[model samples]
Target chain A: MLQTKKWRQYATFYAFVSPWLIIFIFLGLFPLLYGLYLSFTNFTGFNMNQLKFVGFSNYKTVFLDSESMYALGRTLLVTAINVPISLAIGLFLAVLLNLKIKGLSWWRTAFYIPSVVPVVSTVLMWKFIFSGDGLLNTLFDKLQLQPINWLGYEYATTALIVMLLWGAGGSLLINLAGLKGIPADLYEAAEIDGASPVRKFFTVTLPLMTHILFFNLIMGIIGSLQIYIQPILLSGKTLLDSPIKPNYLYLVHAFQQIFAFQRFGYGLALMWVLFIAILLLTVLVFYSSRFWVYYETDQEV
Target chain B: MMVNAGINKPLLRVVVYGLLTVLTIIFVYPLFITMANSLNPLYSLSTLLPTAFEWENYKMAVTTIEFPEYLKNSLIICAISVPLTTLSSALAGFAFARLRAPGKKLLFVIITSTMMLPGIVTQIPTYILFHKMNFIDTFYPWLLWGIGGAPFFIFMYRQFFSTVPKELEEAARIDGCSTFRMYATIFMPLATPATWTTVIMLFQGTWGDFITPFMFLRDEHYPLATALATIGYHLPDNPNVILAQPSSAAAILFMIPTIAAFFFGQRYLVDGIAAGAVKG
Candidate 1:
């Protein structure tokens, strides 16, 4: 009788969740599996009918291709550079805002406003800021310094980094929440024990906030790796204008090869490789996080 | 923790106020410059402040970009997608929190695990899938993705739902309310804050999103972001295009809705994100 009741309850539960399951299976998992199969075949353009069973050749081409290799390198480099810098800045800002300062809410809101702005607007804003005769250049001219090429190959990455910092508001907002969650009693106890703010921060705040930090780090890395619109818009591509030919950025190269050149097999192969690389990195991070990511539950540890 | 300090703490006050002033300037100055430069008659690259406020740039921006059409499209997409996403996620969230089911834990794990997969991996395949389904140029694919509950949204709703008192739901059930009715009448009303948070998030996300519309929609169907991009980059020579004014104006206009939403929903956002993080 108990088993029958449990079964009925389970049926109701499953019925409620069936919509999401059906969508995930059909739209998410099916496409993923089919795409995996297609990656091993020679499928190009919009023609699924023309697929040939090529078996590992497409993967080989991706591995051997210089352009793909360059893209892979650039993507990793950007992630490596941007993630740590953003995290540090975000943490610093959060800590500053967390202090019992006047107009705290207003300050927090101000810092977060930039992140909520539309991407196209932000990109356009940055483009104007970085233009040869735009704001930055004008400032340089007033200072009697030579104007730098902000969008040229040597400086484009730097420009991207600057633009990215404006969006650090999201990370900062989350970190502020993490800061607020740390108990006041713990800090008071530490102070009574003659611990300096710096010592208490390292020993208590940093260790306890690791979980939130880890979440932010993983999300930031993943988001940065897939960056497209900013660079695409910055390069000034339009419907009427010829598609901005990608320069050295690996993402642009991969995007062009897939969309512009109609090499779906190669694109799929490239995407899969990226997927595996990210998956491995994430696994490695989680594995190492056992030492540092302090879960509230001892069972998790 | 209150400090018993003298009233004449002049040095400390000066330092604190100075630091705050500098940071505030850094944050607010860009908006001021953008708004100011947009009204300048010449639209020249030289001036930091407009010699005279033209007021014509706003008019040009509205007329030239067909701002009304773009705004209409954005409203329609947000209106359709936000409610659908909120409803679906809320239902699934309630199930996870309240229902006892076989494979519940397994399903939760599966859904959460999907969060680990980077969006880039799915982009090409999903694009191909949508293309094949004849959804490339239409708004259907964009709407579908938005309405489809992502792991983050599900996790949030579940966390929020778990906090509600079970007695309320039980009483409703005892009053001959079906599970659906109980959910609709009792649970949903109690979860108004969570619903509002979800709506604000979905609205901002759909409003600001540039990539999906850029990739999927053609020129005639281009939304505000795409239109802004075109004005900023493509129509540099066409002075008549409203978006062709100094980039600052375009940026300011684009920021207005998002900034407004953030301020309006500020309290809920901080609470929701913080609580959600702990539960997650």
Candidate 2:
């Protein structure tokens, strides 16, 4: 009976997780391996019959192709610029909101309203607002200054960043959660030790908030690096017409390659390169975390 | 909730509240203008307020696209997918948190590491896989993804379940409760916050996802995100200028579900939801 019970317990675990296993095996694991396999072959999506193993050539193209290199560099530039600005602004807002203010929830709701609005809808609205006769240019005209091309090639990237930062409430909410997660008793203890507010923040709050900041860093990096849709939407065009060269993000480039140009194998190769790069960077972040990220739990990583 | 413990209280209040109030206006003004424009006729450079409360633009917004069909499809897809994503993720997360199983540690590693994998590496092959299986243009692929257990939501549920005191789990087991019973009866009820968070996330993700529909589904079956795109929502400012009103109006309509989800979910997301889970 005990032996039967052990078998039953094992079966129970499988029973609960069998759905995930079945779906993931066929959909997630198989496709990932298949993509890797395709990356090694000369599969042009429809050339299932005339396939040949052409290893490393596609990967070689990723490094040598000037456009690909530019796209990668631009992605890095975007990640670098957007991540820090977003973190600074988000953390600042979260800090402000963390105080014992009246109607805290109401303020949070009002603040987050813009972010929760549908992106497709909002993108168009922003497009209009940035249009030549739209509000911004109009204000310029009213001030007796020459109207600026807000959506022109020169300013489109800045326009895209503005749109993104406007909706950075997700950052605010997470930081608030992090702030709350810091035990209040820690603050009281610091007060007892005669630490000034500034000193307490630097010593007590900053150390405890590092884990959350680390979470934000990793998420921000991953998110900003893979940003594809914003440029596509903001460029006022379909996937066929690329976002202006300035906003031609790497994923967007890979997308155009696979779908528009039908370089399936090459696209797979490009993606794998990105995958490895992300893996390396993420590992670097994790390694760096040993020095900065603080933790109370001994939970296994 | 206090910060700046040394500052005079009234002075601090005046400054903080004053700054936040100004900041709120700065943030919300653009949206307010857009809302005003949606209800009124064309917004010239100078006009900041609406003279009329005409919802004709909203009427046009619904009529302009395959709104009814697309809305139905979105509703059907989210209604089915959100619960599937939430429940299955919760179950897997609970197992990771509580159960002793073979290769559990390895599975946890797999779960975390897969998150670092760029989504495109899998999308190409998955698209082909779906095409070969003849699941393209159908909701089966979405249903399948939901069953696959979103790795992110699983991590969330795992974190929540892990933080619940071990004594509670032990007490449930001592009462002759099966592990599954402990999950369904004890933990699931206590996990409303995590569940709500996952629900909103899954709903918004599925709602905003145009790529899946754009790539796979025929135009007739396109959802809101895809529909809005092909309907020439792009601004050219002259011939298509009249289209702006309906578009802004549609944006407000489009925002409702996700915003509603946030309002409902935010209550559960309040401070230390799990702190109260452990009973005396």
Candidate 3:
């Protein structure tokens, strides 16, 4: 009787969770493993049945390919620059917003509004901001300064970076939550010990916020590397004038390889390379976190 | 934790307010610019403000972009996907949180690991599979995310459901209720906050997604994001002009729903994300 009851209970459990389990295996796992296999073969567009398995050749081509290498370099450069800039801005805003200022939620809402704005609209706003005759140049004209071409090939990347920083409010919210999580008694104790505001912030605030910062950093790096929409919107093929070349990032390159050139095998191979790199880099970040990431529980023990 | 600002208190307040005001302006300046540019009759940069405000630009944008169709498509996608995703996630979350299941921990770890697999790794095969299944150009690929959405929401729901007191379930069980009955009647109603959080997030995500629709759907089936992006990128026959008024209007129109959603749902949105940060 107990055995029958146990089987019934197990059936109920499976019934509750089966939706996610069944769908994930069929939709997610199947595609991922199939894609991995495709990376090893020359699977051209619309020719799924004729895939010729060429072991290691696709990986070899990806490594030696100049365009692929350049795309990777550009992606890394973006990750390096954008992630730190976003963190600094986010942390700075979080600190200010935590000051118990009046209309705190209103101020936060204003800052965070941009981050949640649809990407299409956000990119459209940036297009005007960086346009030759747009707001920045209008300001330049008012100040009697020469108008610089912000979207020129030389300055396009910088313009894109500035646009990205406008969305740092997302991370600011995370950091602010982290700040709020710190116990009030720590600050009280610090004040009792005669620590200055600056000292209190450095010793108590910064150390406690490291884990949040670490989380944001990992997310930032991962997000920046896969950036597609903004760059594609800015420089992608459209009916309007063409943007100057050399603005294509990794995803765009892979996209063009698959859709534009019908090199499905090469595109999948590029994706695998990106995947392996992300895994390694993520592992490295976790490994390196031992030195800087703080744990209150660890200290207590 | 309070410190005496002394005579400098007012000055410090002024400084704080001044800094925040400036930052707010900086944050929202582009939006003002977009609105201004969209209203300008001549579509000229000669004046920062519109010399003549024109409603014609908005009309032209709507007509040119088939804005109604885009809006309808987006609403349809969000309506179906949100409920399906929330239901699936909530059910699964409840199971993992309360039910006696074998290999539950292992199963959860596997699902969570899916979060790390970048979409690009699966993009090609999924596309081909969908194509083979004749799902391209249909909303099926996106709508099907109801079943196989990202594990982010599932993980979040699990975190949330785990916090609910187990006595509620025990009481429901002692009353001879079925497992589904207890989940639906007792637990789910209590998880209203998590439900709202999941719905809002899923809605926002479905609402904003461009590339998926851009890839899978035809022009007629385009959602708000893809429609707006394409129209903004390719506003016919006006390349050199900085702010093509019609396209700019379209952009503003695209922003309206999302901005409204954020303002109304800010509390839940913030709480949800913060919870994720804490738990993840």
Candidate 4:
């Protein structure tokens, strides 16, 4: 009777969990492996049965292809710049909002409202701002300053970065949540020790919040690398003719290759390269966390 | 919050208010411009207000982008996907947290690790898989995976379910409640916050989603986000365009539901995010 009860429990467990299991296996794991397989074979997405196993040729092409190489470099540069600046701005806003102020929720809502607005909308608004005859240039004209072409090759990446900064409030909200998690006692202790507000922030708050910072850092790197829609929406004519714009990042390149050029095998291979880069970067971050990230549990220990 | 006690109180108040006001303007200005321009096709950068209130932009957006069809597809996807995803995610969470299923840890690790994987790595193969199964072009690719595919949601749910005291489940089990019964009758009600969190999160994600629909769906089946993006892409090529009136209007229409969702669900959204941040 006991053995049968255990068996029944096991069966129920499987029944309860099999939905996620089935989906993960079929939709997640199977496809990932198939993608790896397709990366090896020269499949142009025309016919599955016509796949030709080209061994390491696709990987070679992804590395050697000029557009792919430039895209990788450009994406890395954007990620390197965008992640830190955005996170800094987010942290700054979060610190400000953590104060004892009225309408705090309203302020947060106002800030985060842009984040929830559709990306297409945000991109559209920015497109108007950056257009030659748009808001910024119009302002410059009134100031009697030379009108710089914001969407030109010189400023395209900068335009993308500026546009991305508008949604920094999303990360600010996350950082606010992180700030809230820090125990009040830490700040009190620092205060009793006669620490200044700046000192207390550095010693008590920043240290305690490093884990959250780490989380955001990892997420930021991953997210910034996969930027697709903004570039696609903003590029307009630049990307259609030449896929090598400063704003034409990695995922956009992969997308144009796969969907636009019908280079399925090549696109998948490029993504695999992207995957490896992200994994390495994430691992580096994780490995480096031992020095900076702190836990209250560590203090207790 | 209490750290500024030593400073000049009145000065501090002024600084805080000043900072908030400036930030609020910075945040809301572009949106205000967009909303104003959406209503005024004769938009110019010189004035923040429109010369005339014109309904033509809205009409133009509707006709040019097939706004109604896109909205219908988005609603259909959200309506079907959100509830199914939430329910399955909760079930998975309950099983992982409350039950003694073997290999649960390993399975969960596999799921969570997918978060680190570049999404595009899986995109092509998943597309091909759906293609092979003839699930492409239909809503099946979205509905199926949406219901059971969110490892992050499952993780969130598991974290929540773990917090429910074991005594409640033990008591429920003593009354001969089946696992499903205990989950349904006892634990699910307690998981309301988690459910709401998942609902809002998944709703926003599905609604704002562009890549999936852009890649998979035909023009007839495109969501509002994709349709608007596609139109926005081609707008500059139109020589007849003077002020991006139709695009601005399309943007406003696309943003309405999300803004409404934010206003209605801000509390749950913030609470959910706080819970994730605290626990994770």
Candidate 5:
């Protein structure tokens, strides 16, 4: 009877999670493996029956293609600029608010609200502001400043950076949580020692908050690398049309290769290689994290 | 929260408040411009505030597209996807936390590892899969994805469930409560915070999802979010001459639901981010 009951319980566990199993196996895992297969075949999306295996050529093309190389370089540059600069602003705001500021919730709400606005809406708002005779130019005109086309090639990346900083509130919340997590006694001791606020920040706050900053850094890099819709919307272009060359990030380039050009095999290969790039960078970050990312652990003793 | 560590309080207070006010304007100004310009097209877009209250811009925006149908489609997408994804995620999460089955540990690790995988890798194959299944241009993909259970939410629910005191679960098990019943009656009631966090996130995610529908659907089937791309294309000949009037009105309308979600779930949302970050 006990054996039967155990079997029934096990069956029930499987039964309860059956939906996830079905979907994950077929949709998640299968598609991932199938993508790898498709990358090796010269599949132009429409030619399923006439699929010819072309080994390693698609991968070679992804690496050798000049536009693809440029896109990768651009994406890395943007990610590099975005992560530290945005996080610094976020940390600064968090520190400002952590000083027992009046109306803490109100301050938080004001800051955190923008980050939650749908990316589509945010993009549209910025696009309109960047339009030829948009509000921004009008403001510039009022001040008698030169009203250049804010949406032009030179300023396109600048526009992206502005949008990045606008949502810096996201990192603020995380940093604030980290700030609050620091023990009060440390600050108390710092105060008793007559340490200045700046000294206390470096000695007490920064050391404890390294892990949170590290985590934010990882997430920000990963998220920024996937940026596609923003540039597309900002340029007022569709997925089919290429954004201005400066705005062409790797994902957008890969997307155009697949959908616009119907280079399915090439696109799949492009993504797989990009995946490897991401994995390698992530591994490097993990490897280097030991030098910078501090963690409280058993090894501390 | 630390209040004092030999900082000059009054000087810091003045400086902080001054900077906070400036930051507030910088953050909220563009949104304000959009809302203000949305009011009336005839007025200049120069002002910091709304010049006129013209509700006609919105009505015109609606008439420009198949607005009602797309609105219904968005709602239906949200209705189907959010609850289904939330529940399935919770179920899987509760099981992962509370139940014992062979290979469960391995499966959990695999699912969580996908978080680090660049999402673009599977984009093509998943599109091909959906196309083959004739799931293209339909709500079928959301149904399947909802059941697939987003790994992030699963982790969130699992974390929430794991924190529940063991005695409560054991007492219920001793009372002969089935695993499913224990999840629904005991754990779920306790998991309301996680549920709301997951639900709001799911809702916002579904409501604002453009890429999925952009990939899969025809123009007739686009949701409110994707459909907005069609509006204010009044001058196709001069693409640069974007009339920011009715589009801004529409943009504000599109923004309302998500801004509402933010207001409603701010606490849970913050907690969720903090939880996810701490795990990382």
Candidate 6:
């Protein structure tokens, strides 16, 4: 009797969540599996009849392709540099904002306003700033420094990174919340022990804020890895820019090959590789976090 | 001792004030430049301050972009989608948090797992599906996806509902309240902060969304972001075209609604985000 009741209870629970499950199965899972299958076949534009199951060949092409290899390397390099620098600046700003100062709320709002601006506008604003005779160059000239080509091949990536960091206030705001959650008593005790503010921060603040740091670190990595809009918009691509900067072109090329060229199989393969890379990186971070991540609850590892 | 303490306090206050002012400028100057340039009269772009205010640029960009039509489309889409997204997520969240049903944990896990998938991966297939249904050009797909509710919203509401006390619901149940009333009267009112957070987030997200409308909507139905993107990208050739003149003006107009919303609801947004960061 108890078993039957329990089963009915489960059924009732599943019924409530049925809507999401149904959508996920059809929209999310089906497409994923279909994409994976399409990656192995030579499926082109709107026709699956021509899809030949030439297994491993598409994977081989992507792996050995010089252009794709360069894109992969570039993506990794950009992510590595962008993540740390943005986090450092964001943490610094969070610390600044957390201090008890007058008009603090206004300051917080000012810093966060840019983040809520539509991406199209933000990109356009950056475009204006980076133009040959734009604000950046004008400023450099006034400072008596030689003006660098802000959007040239050598500096375009750097410019994008800088644009990205301007909106770092969103993450910084979250960091402030984490900072506030740290018990005030801990800081008071540290001060009583004659610890310097810097020492207290390193010991009390940083240690307690690890969970939030972990959250930000994961979110930042995931968000940056799928970077598409800013580069595409700023670089003047209408659809997918063809012959993407040899370094930045691979993901776009893969996307185009799937959608434009009808090489669904190849696109799927590329996607799978990306998925695995992200999953592995996340898992690695979580596994290594055993040493540093401080959970409030005594949950099992 | 008293003299030294007073001296140190003032010095610290001055340093804090100085640092904050510099930081504010760093954050606000780009926006100021964008706004100022939009109102500049000269067709030739200047890097420094504008000599005169040109109000015509704003009017011209609005007319050329067919701003009224774009604004209507944005409002209609957001109005329909935000409520549907919030209500459905709240329902699902309530069920997950309060129901005594089985498989809740598994269902929750399944919903969250989808967050790992990048949106672009799902774009092509969804397009194909919508095309088959003959809903490509229409707003049906956008509405349907929004109504389906997002995992992030669901997760947020679940955490929020969990924080609500069980005693209220128990007392209501003893008073012979129906299950629906129990949720509507007790649970929903208590979860106002979370609901508002979800609504604001969905509103902001839907308003700024470009990729979906760009992929699905026809040219006649372009949303604000898509319309602006079209102008920004296509205006290089004819600078004198009414739409092309003072391109920065159009960008400024695109951002106005969002900036306004952020300032007005900033306190709630901050509180919600803070709670979310801790619980999430």
List fnat, each candidate: 0.48, 0.55, 0.59, 0.60, 0.60, 0.47
Instruction: Write the residue-wise lDDT of candidate 6 on B114-173 in tens digits.
Output: 677777777766777778889888898767776577888888778878887888878997
Q: What total of clashing residue pairs does each candidate reach?
A: 3, 0, 0, 0, 0, 2
Q: Report the C-alpha lDDT of model 3 over B15-36, residue by residue, as the tens digit.
A: 7789899999989878887888
Q: What tens-digit string does per-residue lDDT give for candidate 4 at B1-280? A: 3545644478878988898899999898888877777776454453354555678878877876577888999998888788988888888888888887678789888877887887668877887777778877799887787657477888888888888898998999899998899999988998787788888878888898877887678889988877776654234467346447777778888888888887877777777776665577
Q: Against the hidden reference, what TM-scores do the models get? A: 0.91, 0.92, 0.94, 0.95, 0.94, 0.93
Supply the global lDDT for candidate 4. 0.80
Tell me the tens digit of each residue's lDDT in model 2 across B66-141: 7888888888778778888888999998887777668778877888888777766788898888898898888887
| Model 1, residue pairs in steric clash | A71-A250, B60-B242, B61-B242
Cα lDDT tens digits for candidate 1, A157-213: 778777887777678767987887787777777778878667777877888789888
**Superposition error at A157 for model 1 (Å):** 0.9
Which whole-number lDDT from 0 to 100 does residue A77 have in model 3?
Answer: 82
Output the lDDT of residue A158, model 1. 78
**Candidate 5's error at A161, in angstroms?**
1.4
- Residues A1-301 of candidate 5 have per-residue lDDT tens digits of 9988888877877886788888988988898999999999999988999999999999999889999999999898889898889888888888888886678878887787777788878888888787777778888888999887877989898888788778988887789878878889888888888887788889888888889888788778888888877887788555466777798999998888888899999998988887777777777888898998778772678
* Alpha carbon lDDT at B177, candidate 2: 95
Better of 1 and 4 by TM-score: 4
Model 2 local distance difference test score: 0.78
Highest lDDT model number: 5
TM-score (0 to 1) for chain A, all models? 0.93, 0.93, 0.93, 0.93, 0.93, 0.92
**Each candidate's DockQ score against the native complex?**
0.49, 0.50, 0.58, 0.60, 0.60, 0.46
Indicate whether candidate 2 or candidate 6 has the larger DockQ. Answer: 2
CAPRI classification of candidate 1: acceptable
Give model 6's DockQ, 2 decimals. 0.46
